[model samples]
Target: MSARRQRWEIRPPAPADVRERLGLPPLLATLLYQRGLLDPAAASAFLAADYATGLHDPFHMRGMAEAAARIAAAIDRGELMAVYGDFDVDGVTAVALLTQAIGAMGGRIRPYIPHRAREGYGLNNVAIGQLAADGVRLLITVDCGISNYAEVVEANRLGIDVIVTDHHHPPAELPPALAVVNPKQPDCAYPFKGLVGVGIAFKLIQALARYGKRPANLRGRDMLDLVALGTVADMGPLLDENRVLVRAGLIALNETARPGVRALMAAAGLAPGLIDSGAIAFALAPRLNAAGRLADARRAYELLLAGDRETADGLAAELNATNRERQALTRQLQARAEELVAQSGRAEQPLIVLASPEFNAGVIGLVAARIAETYHRPVVVIEQGGETSRGSARSIPGFSIIDIFDQCADLFVRYGGHAAAAGFTIATAQIPALEQRLLTLSRQYLRDDQLAPRLMIDAVLPLTELSWELYAGIQQLEPFGQGNPQPILMAPNVTAIDPQPTSDGAHLRMRVRAGNSVFEAIGFHFGRLAEALQRYPTIDLAYQLAVDEWNGQRRMRLLVRDFRRAGGARNGG
Candidate 1:
């Protein structure tokens, strides 16, 4: 089925003098202004995101002093410490970061990652008991444990000290851990609350380093590569301290000499220099996550901690194959989910809830996210077990999945996530009632227009303005991800000279002409638009600037986002 038509909302350009005031090109200034960076100092700081000035003080986060002190004491006393983490990329990277840091500081450390299909997310009593039996006295959790009130109690009962370092939304009642180092905590005064699990872990190490207790070789910046991987993989907003960490981390990532990192990059077909946030998100993160999605995530964690080239290469190859398998399975499940939604005649419903006993529990989140993006609505995919079902949900922009789960708290055994994504567990018998209740709530909260995707265009420029200088200036905004996305520019009255579908009929490629200028453009997944473009060859296109390299020469290209017939009545904007 064709995707829903998108509504365009073009932002007005900033004042002309913004260029003079901000010392940037007019287009760059306009983009920055639209992002609320109007002051010159702020714009300059954003453009030159130096880590030294950008990263927040580690001690500013509430509970940092206590967490650091406890960790230092444990190191001094030579207590056996265990780093417990989730199964996803964020959790695994956090585990690697903390374990490496602690080991470097002369502490005996072990990493414990729960299996996604078996033990599930967060801290568990069985694992705690096993660790305690192994003589572990200090347990540090990464990317999880915020909502594990009962598990925290279990750890305490086992005589294990727990320090929770997570970025997930905290519950009304906090856990009874020794220290909770989360910026989202109510009493926390941390300036940036958008740190991912690894970012929080980095801050903890930073605090330890400041106290002169960290390993001599393990500086805060040395782990920025891990920080960038986990933060970008988890979709943390690239603003404030997150921006600083990611920007610096990208540099570290490109220059990293770690055997595992180099091997993974080679497998992902990425070059060694000038890696960006997009590369990590699209190439590296998925391969790392493939292990957790299909099997044990410990392989991935060990790969990042691999000390030998042969070991790293073998792990990277395994993960690459797993990622390929994962992609195939995800596509199969997504097609099945679409058919189910269509068969149920719930096409117009605000929320899409799907479930099957055949569904793989590990891949439900990926399928839910894909369906939500395609339908432009909130989606929930559940994997039915014997008596209970596990569910993963993805939400649209305005709807908060976590907030919605909060409203229906009684429906699930346990639930936790961010604004746009979440997971839960409930009895299989409650599926029908949960679906109906969710539909009712969605109907009340969502508007008709909210169901359609909305494209926010930053500026409307003519083809004549597409100069190399403009593109170079825009490149200053590196490491774009959540909260700071690549700018989308609109060009109107571009005549479609010729449009043809790819050989596989999965995409549309064409040459567009504006006056005397011609530009090549590709519309991914827009093969269905070939016939329409033939009917009306003139279009107003929204796209992001891209460069195609051929024979070591760079040529401009347009990555088509959306388009409409030329001279049509402007809608939404």
Candidate 2:
């Protein structure tokens, strides 16, 4: 094990109106105020996520009018239409949403999701030819087709009109599609710029509703489930319109989800009526993503759109198995990646770029995220194949992987994504050159302080303020992510009254006291820190206050995130 000592820093939140309005205890109020819900009305609205108030008019996006017009024309003339999507959860959800929406609009529609291992991502010429051969006159691409200039050109040549509805960053030259509906486009004026691929498709559906061309009886909230699934899975920020969509979508997901989602939740041992972002992130998303990661993405697409319970259950089981397989593969690949990083003798390099022919391309992004987290640096993992190498990248906050790739555009055959996550392809021979170029770019852009990992704390609190009433008051800041994160509070000199090792030493069950209040706390995935339990009877802990319910009992529990030896005047020692 490495002997690197973990550092601790505490920054207290500025006081606000949390105590007065919600009758909250002081510590909980400070944490809530720091998270930006300083006003009572705003706090109420944030928790409620008023579905009616949050949703935007679908026609607000730039190309909605044109895209909807074309689709409406296709419906009027009864032209064959195809919904093209990517293979991941976001892509699968987009395909499901659009195909369902279009079918409801009395339009003849078929769904097409590219094979992850074979055809790769985005709209390809081969798929275009196949669609054309099948008598498809109009093709609307979801989750992809923004940067497929050559493929779009080929699609037009094959007499297929393409409408690109994507969220990926656009290149210098746009694809020659009928209309591009990406909010990331330089000149576009979409109010909410943080839409994922499914969000874009949702906008198109909204536009159809405005034109009175939508399915007359289709419920809008029914589609929110898909929007929530894709948005969270793609790691889109849970703020602005995304926050609105996901908040409502989670409610819909829990109450009236599709057969596939219902079956998936059952397999994952999650209650459908009580789903949250955590459930989607940890359970549903991975299962849907597994099909694309290890096998054909079509399996996921089929599962989501299955008509019968038996079919949906079977597919969900298969996807669950695939997810298990994917998890094992990722572990193996991560070990190999760590070995490569060790051998390179350049661990401190600003950007990590590693390539191996044996690495699975599907899980490279996840591998990149793991490597980035471990090293506190940006990472790009590449899988070198016969003629070309595919790569996936994840970045730290201050670093932009897409911008870095844009600087070395000459080396890539294709590249696209947001600032944080990106994907690309290049000739196998250009890997070294591309790596060197990205490192040089990183050295120029990254500051020394930016490279160090820092945890942002919402506030510092005394132990006396942790109460059931205060915990309930904090619920006003619900559905947190991106701009709004779950608040972390630090309390010093908290004595662990009862500390017991749990579950093969992976966790700790403890009761801690601060002033007059005593709370049950669990330190998850902190078995390695067991030695510190005996060394420090009273310590400082950073944690989230939550209500843990078990067998009809409800009590406040501290979900311990980080801990350190207490210091300064407050330390009883």
Q: Can you give the TM-score per candidate against the true fold?
A: 0.97, 0.92
Q: Residue-wise lDDT of candidate 2 within 1-573, one digit each (tens)?
A: 111123445545445445787555665556556656677776556566677787677666777789999998998899999999999999999999999988998999999999888888888888889999999999999999988999989989989999999988888998988888988887777788899999988889888877777775668888889999999999888877898899889888998647888888888888766788877888999999999988999899888878778999999999999999999999899999999999996587988899999799989999999999888899999999888999999999878888888899999988888899999889998999998999899999998877876666566676787666666656655566566667777787888776777868868888888888888888876666666676776887778877756677887788887776666323211
- In candidate 1, what are the lDDT values of residues 1-573, reduced to their tens digit? 112277788888888777678877788889899989988999989888888788888899988999999999989899999999988999999999989998999888899999988888888899999999999999999999999999999999989999998889899988999999899999899989999899999999889987777776766777889999999999999988888899989888998878999999999988878478888999999999999999799999989989999999999999999999999999899899999989997668889999898789889999999889888999999999889999999999989888878888888888899999999889999999899889989999999888978888898888878999988988998779999999988888999867989998979999998988889999998988888898889888888988877567999999889888777445443
Among residues 3 or more apart in sequence or in different chains, the pairs in candidate 2 whose N, CA or C atoms overlap within 3 Å are none
- The 0-to-1 C-alpha lDDT of every candidate, in the order given, reads 0.89, 0.83
Look at candidate 1 and give me any clashing residue pairs. Answer: none
CA RMSD for every model? 1.8, 3.1
Clashes of each: 0, 0
